[model samples]
Target: MTAISESGPSGFPPGYFLITSTATGRVLDVGGQAIDDGAELILWPSKEVSLVQSRRSPEADNQVFFVDDSGALCSRSSGHAIDIDHDRLVLRHRKPASFAHPFPKFSYHQELGEINVKFDGDPTRNMYILTSVPLRKPKSFIDDASQFLTTNIRTPFASLFGGVDTNSTPEQMTSAGVDLAEDEVLEEERGEEGEIDDSPDEKREIHMLTIPHQRPWNLAEKAKLRRRFEIIPLRTASKRTTGITV
Candidate 1:
């Protein structure tokens, strides 16, 4: 199996990708192309049975995923994020609840080639590693059982992104908006540039102008009225005051 990269390929943000398991050689799929909440994730054969195939496979939208800014693996078909519930992986709404944070953040581990889940900003917790196991569902939920995607294993079952698959070409990667050459050029340009200075260029004094309330304004009424104020920079105010009587 090809070693997975620690980080995603260049320009990989917001790009569609297939998460294929190294153990079973199957891709992570949403069961029944489901868009509803609590849909279980399963491992299914790839549309073309090749890791190098195009991401535009017919009826493969449920298989395509992109990492969101929050680091959640989001499904393109359901617009939901992969979440852990009762030690099982399922698709859930990405919105955060008042009591808990947003969906758990996921990071790719190069050494183990597994996707690690982080919860409540704790990394040392012996959480779970994404793995594929024989489907075990309640008889009431499903009649037939197959392979299911899970995260309740100690040993990590490595998965590879289609963009970083060894067999994938630059053109194939570019189809998902990853341009290796362009990223290389940009990286080189960044290295040649000088260090950036984040300090403010100039200091400015601020003067707030407040308008007094009318005579009829009582203390309560004054409190109710919104305060009107304007800010004047020291330099600009000084320029305006030049040649004017104080």
Candidate 2:
């Protein structure tokens, strides 16, 4: 349960990252390094180079874009951002006047660690999903941001993801065809070792300190996090943009 760092004022970590599509397995790319205003953004098949770029340590912004506070994806080289034009995502000069028309606000899906980009003043219409290539996908949706941030993204799902068990050994699952539910597999193993009825007189070592040490909770720190999530707006907006509709 490693804690995730709070992304900056822009609601995203400032660095170079490859935005990918979960449905298409494609990466969001700028065409021809276009710097003209209104240059269109398109999806391209992810390449080995794209993977390398996605995992690159935050360096020079060659293929990288900076997410600004207004939800604009700013090109590092051009100093422009991907602005919304009608329904199309394009590169444009981000200015105060065009803010209402082009810039998109974003929402985070806690379950999958996916970012949903939607138009400002509108929430439902034309929502686009954004993901990173190197990041680990989350297991299940958690309501609390603090809890979600602390959760392990690689945790195995009991019902979803084709029945993967993080605790199960490869040999054990290989014998079961890896199709059975994790509990069922564990039950069979438990059956082999019969349940024992322990006597009160029997002495067993109790590691009391281990439990508390495993989950270190500080009241002041938890209250601080709770307050932060409250201001952060975890819930999605109810309405979408004016022109777009479901």
Candidate 3:
């Protein structure tokens, strides 16, 4: 599976992807598990599949948002927690009560995910049902996600979003997004570069990235990045405060 780049919240990779199964028409995860048999197809949330995925939660209660393969905006359920686990995009009301339904007669596909077969009382009836967008690693209730930067818990989820304020303008949001993207790219390149260094300095550069005092690990993934040729932080002046600052 492709790895998500380490960076800001946006760098967090989706735990599941939506794809179609060959035997059944249902979409599958990267592992080929059905998103759910007969999962109503929709667009992925990136605007374009190639664009970065959105990390923020649903903004509207009346709407269900999901990352359709086409990366367009669409609704899933009125308000159910849709999740992408392994290969299946499971959708159902996120409640302890809903799981009381009976099991299937065939070999249990617990790993195949909760099947939503609709039997209208006939021997093999079709139960027509629907659900909402996908959520990853669903718990009883979602909470703040901490990256656990250290064993001690000094860092918080808010740290990922430090510096910026809620009142910032659209221009600021755009600038921040650009910076995060660049940092992600640079880190990826550095990882690639670290593998093929041949010269003395190249070897030294790789070695120094792990040095303790240099604080190689101090930089946030979204901050500006530079070639850590020798345990350096990747940074640059923001145009807003570049030459105009005191």
Candidate 4:
């Protein structure tokens, strides 16, 4: 298969063009004309392109895409680059050149009519972008857990123990002016009032009851936990089509 780089043998420069799948005869479309990030790319019916006019047609912005110099395929309407999100294609804000993201570069096969997307230029992990069906929302166990911890657990836990340094040891708390002797004072008061129950049953009950000790939750550690996702190509059929240009 003859591979075509971003600058194709057809001498087509990086400009807005309708990317149509030869297999499905459907063009790459931003689902629902969504302008938000993480919008899925789907295959939709191709719109008519005016060959004579060099300008874009109205209401066709969602269907037209262009390859940037970085080889990122970006939608004309949203200006977001197409990237792999949980193995599905999604739109994301273009990261600054200095920042490195897992976005791959796009190339084409001249004879096969296939778009070749490679991550880190690895041929073993080459992915094809082709699908007529709408993509389902991606789910991640780690993301859900992170969200639950951040929203339901962490917030309330922090508020309940406001100003209490959970990270501090008992000695650190004492050094920080915490009245550790208050418990001893209460015990002394109970002893003076003869309120100490030295009954065998009471002692046995106390011995049986055990509180499991858990490590103090560190809010700083949450910052280090990153949300991980993978890009998986949708392989719906074997008869892949060469993506057409409009």
The candidate that wins on lDDT is 4
Best-to-worst order by TM-score is 1, 4, 2, 3
Model 4: what TM-score? 0.44
Worst 10 residues of 4 by lDDT: 202-211
Cα-based lDDT at residue 23, candidate 1: 39
Candidate 3 lDDT over residue span 192-231, tens digit each: 2222222222001100011123323332332112211010
- Which stretches of candidate 4 lie above 4 Å from their native place? 1-13, 52-56, 96-102, 121-246
Q: Cα lDDT of model 2 overall?
A: 0.42
Q: Identify the runs in model 1 with alpha carbons over 4 angstroms from their true place.
A: 1-14, 49-55, 96-100, 121-124, 134-246
The TM-scores of all predictions, comma-separated, are 0.46, 0.39, 0.17, 0.44
**All candidates in order of lDDT, best leading:** 4, 1, 2, 3
TM-score, model 1 to reference: 0.46
Model 4: per-residue Cα lDDT over 106-155, one tens digit each: 55544445454556755443233322221213337995576455454444
**In model 1, how large is the Cα lDDT of residue 118?**
60
C-alpha root-mean-square deviation, each candidate: 28.9, 21.2, 24.7, 22.4
Which regions of candidate 3 fall more than 4 Å away from where they truly are?
1-16, 20-47, 54-91, 96-99, 102-246
* Per-residue lDDT over 3-40 for candidate 2, one digit per residue giving the tens place of the 0 to 100 score: 12455545555554444444334445565667788876
Task: Give the clashing residue pairs of candidate 2, or none.
Answer: 122-240, 122-241, 123-239, 123-240
